[model samples]
Target chain A: MAFDGDQLSALAAVVHEGSFDAAAQRLHVTPSAVSQRIKALEQQVGRVLVLRTRPCRPTDDGEVLVRLAGQMELLGRDAMAQLVPAPGASRAAPSSRRLPVAVNDDSMSTWFPAAVADLPADVLLDLRREDQELSADLLRDGTVMAAVTADPRAVQGCRVRRLGAMRYLAVAAPDRRDRWFADGLGAEVFAAAPLLAFNREDGLQERFVASVVGRRTTTPHVHYVPSQSAFVGLVEAGLGWGMVPEVAAAPLISAGALVEIRAGRHLDVPLYWQHWALRTPTLDDLTERVVRAAAKALRPVRRHGPPSTAG
Target chain B: MAFDGDQLSALAAVVHEGSFDAAAQRLHVTPSAVSQRIKALEQQVGRVLVLRTRPCRPTDDGEVLVRLAGQMELLGRDAMAQLVPAPGASRAAPSSRRLPVAVNDDSMSTWFPAAVADLPADVLLDLRREDQELSADLLRDGTVMAAVTADPRAVQGCRVRRLGAMRYLAVAAPDRRDRWFADGLGAEVFAAAPLLAFNREDGLQERFVASVVGRRTTTPHVHYVPSQSAFVGLVEAGLGWGMVPEVAAAPLISAGALVEIRAGRHLDVPLYWQHWALRTPTLDDLTERVVRAAAKALRPVRRHGPPSTAG
Candidate 1:
């Protein structure tokens, strides 16, 4: 079935701007006009697409339409970029095309900002911070066009490219290391020494501990720190020991502010750039930038088997 | 009717750990034992408290019990601190008492970490990051024991203390200012200049623009960069003009990398510390630390009238 571009855009704007009035301002239309378009679209779909909350949210049915609208808007901008500009003249900035992408906090704090800083003035980014292991879910549900994910397997209808592996070292402040694990990574140390976690969803520490102990065990004393920079800061402050990214930990470790809890024992989490398998220029450009950034910031991934597969 | 402490702890642990098996490991009990305790608690309350999701979540009723459990645990630790420690002897660390609090990103990246870093080794922190304006919802819903909030008005059953005001300046890279507003702040600037936002929920830029134009108007071109440091970095990269905290912007401004779009017309977001009125020692200690940090980092709030109030 064919849908009107204006109606789809209106529906997308309402969900994006969070209210009918705000959507009107965004689309340069009246609130009544936005309301009429939404109502008409709902009538055509025979399902209520939006929940009239304080910040309007897309219902499950609405999510499908929102994804469709976002794709159309991206493609339309690409078309404009190609068709409107004359040879040797600068391309007109396609200012309003928002590209939604999901990335983990660690990368967000480290190398991701560089990729974003290099974007053309025309394309705006809508970034969502999610755990690396879980970011693929955003792509599956069409909430984002691209994601930085830990899982090599991609969501259906998406393409995945290996973005190398992020290496984490188990480290602690010098004083904390002396006080807690003076002897070594003994079994008793796991139960006694304080450990830091990014959040409940963070399993990096657990994986590191499991590698050492050969079993999944919970640390009785743990601090749940959510921010990327703060997690490293806490470890540097002698609060707890945690798995720190090698790139972030190297300078601190050399400076005597931090020491490796166990030398040469590390966790390398493989990362992938997963995005919708469409030939959109913006998405393609982003993928190239992400792959380049990953190459610079992360350790190269080692593959053992045949590589090419549908994501 | 009196609620069992063991049952309450079990319920809280299950919600925090996100699974019955994980909660069992935390409580040092069998999974069946954890299940029985939850079932008994539900039967006594005559309501379903926990939803059996992949990561178990609290129902509205469960949230009430979770808050109760958290408060009781804090009080229990406070009592133990007094009773268990003798004069001139080192106090035993209460290792597992997780203190959940809500803080905004700007504060979290700056002064807030100092407060957390100073926390006694025993007290663990579970921080929830929300916008200063919306953080009070976590307090109202009993999801957080305390919050750094924008609103002076306190949540129900909570006490409010005037922390201070966080001042924000309208800033852009020197080059960006030269290109976009060569003539200075004009009616056409708001429509033509690209603006930076923390996210969709971030209204600081809009507020700044409205203040300049003497009315609310949309910036047609905008980029939403969510990270605190990244937002400022983008402004320095000549991507767009944005409302940046004065503390963060000052260094860049002095270095001539960033310039004020409009000087002396800054927005001051008055912040407050709101927490449950109950006299728990850890909460009291945390409040003092928060107040001290705010005093050091933010400008003092100017009171108008009627200083004392409930949150």
Candidate 2:
């Protein structure tokens, strides 16, 4: 059975706007019209698509439809951009398209925006700053069209392309490094030294320590600095040692503001661009920009995923 | 009936850790012991306190106990700091205390960290970077012990103290200002010029526009840059105009990279410190530092809150 574009658009709007009245305003229709469309769509599917909550949410079955709607929206916009006369060629102004994307904090602060700066002026970026480990969840839930994620595993109904690895170094303020690791790096030093973390959920420090110690050793003292820039600032301020992205840490190391706690120990997190399987012009354009940015900012990855394969 | 300290700690741990097993690891107790403590507390209150989800969450009833638990924990920590000898004096290292606080991103990027820097070394800050307009919600729900918030009205069981105002200026890159506002400030220009917002939920741009236009006016184009530093960076890159905090804008303004759209037309967002009414030494010390930092960094407020009060 064919899904009516109007009904799918109404469903996307209701879920996106979070209310029937708001959806109606966006669609330039009455609230009753939006409600009728939702009801008719539900009847056609023979399933309850939305949970009529304060902020309307899609049910499990509704998510599948929302993903389809999002894909169609992108394809439609791509088609229009190709067919419509360029701006200033005609009086008809092309409608702006919003592209929702998920990005991690480090990339957002560093290279991601550079890539975004190159996108077409008409595309509105709705960037969600999520953890690299969890960004794929946004794609799975249909909250975002694409994501810069670490997992490298393809989410169901999505395609994954390997971006280069973001290399991290265990660095500390010169004074902090001298004071904490005076004797040399050991399990005791790793356990006692106060660590700077992005947040409690951030596991980079733990993984870094584990790589050196050969076991998971909980550092007794931790300072949670949640901002990417500030996290680096705190490390430079001699507050604690932390895993600084190599791209961000290089300048400080050169300036003698920071020093690696142990020489040559590092973590290289492989990043991947995961997007809907559909090949729309906008998505493909964005993916290209993201991949290009990663190529410049990140180290070349030896292998992409956990289940290793020959390069 | 008296509340058990152990049970309260268990509740806070489980809720904060998001799983009983994780809570058990933090508390150094068996999962069954944590479960039993929760059950006993529920029986004592004769109310269901926790929802048994994958990550256990507090029920509405649970929040009350959690807040009480948080307050009690602070008081206990303060007492120990007073009663115990200094760290070097005894073999027993005083157990570290975790103080959770909510701070807005702009403040967190600028002055908030300075206040936190001066805090006693023993206090581990778990800072939640939330919007100033909504930071108070964290206090209301027992998620944070204190917040640097826009709302001066106290949350239930909390006391409010004014922390001066963060002044904001509508600024654009030199080229951007010359290009976009060459026609001078008017309703049409305001509606058509691209604006930078923290996010879709951010209403600062709309509010700034309304102040100029005498009513709410939607700007046709908006760029959502979520990072505080990156938001300013985008404005400096001549991407769009935005309401920049004066502290950050001052440097850029002096550097000739940014220019104000209209001279002397600024927004002063008065900030306040809201914390649990129970004044522990740690909380008081933190509050004093916050007030001092604000006094130095923020503009003096003419009055605080929606319902104005005589200074």
DockQ (0 to 1) for model 1: 0.32
After aligning candidate 1 to the native by TM-score, how far in Å is the CA of A103 from where it should be?
1.2
Which sections of candidate 1 miss by over 4 Å?
Answer: A1-3, A6-65, A86-95, A132-134, A213-217, A305-311, B10-63, B86-95, B131-134, B305-311
How close to the true structure is residue B50 of candidate 1, measured as C-alpha lDDT?
93
DockQ for every model, please. Answer: 0.32, 0.38
Per-residue error at A36 for model 1, in Å? Answer: 8.5
- Give the 10-residue window scoring lowest on summed lDDT in candidate 2 chain B: B85-94
lDDT of 2 by residue, A1-311 (tens): 89988898899889889998999999999999989998999999999998889789899888888888888888888888888744421122246677888888888887787777745666777877875237766776677899887767898889998888888899998877888888666777776677789887788898888778778787867888888877787777766789988888999899999998877878888888889999877888888888888899988886624522111
Return the TM-scores of chain A for each candidate in numbered order.
0.86, 0.92
Regions of candidate 2 where Cα sits further than 4 Å from its true position? A19-32, A53-55, A88-94, A304-311, B19-25, B53-55, B88-94, B304-311
Residue A130 shift from truth in candidate 1, angstroms:
1.5
Candidate No. with top DockQ: 2
TM-score, cand. 2: 0.92
Cα error, residue A311 of model 1, in Å, equals 29
| Model 2 lDDT per residue over B1-311, tens place | 79999999999888878899999999999999999999999999999988988778899889888999888887887788778753421122246677888888888888887777634556677888875237766776678999988777788889998898888899998987988888887777886677789987777788778788777776867878888877887788776799999888989999999999888788888888998998787888888889998999998876624522211
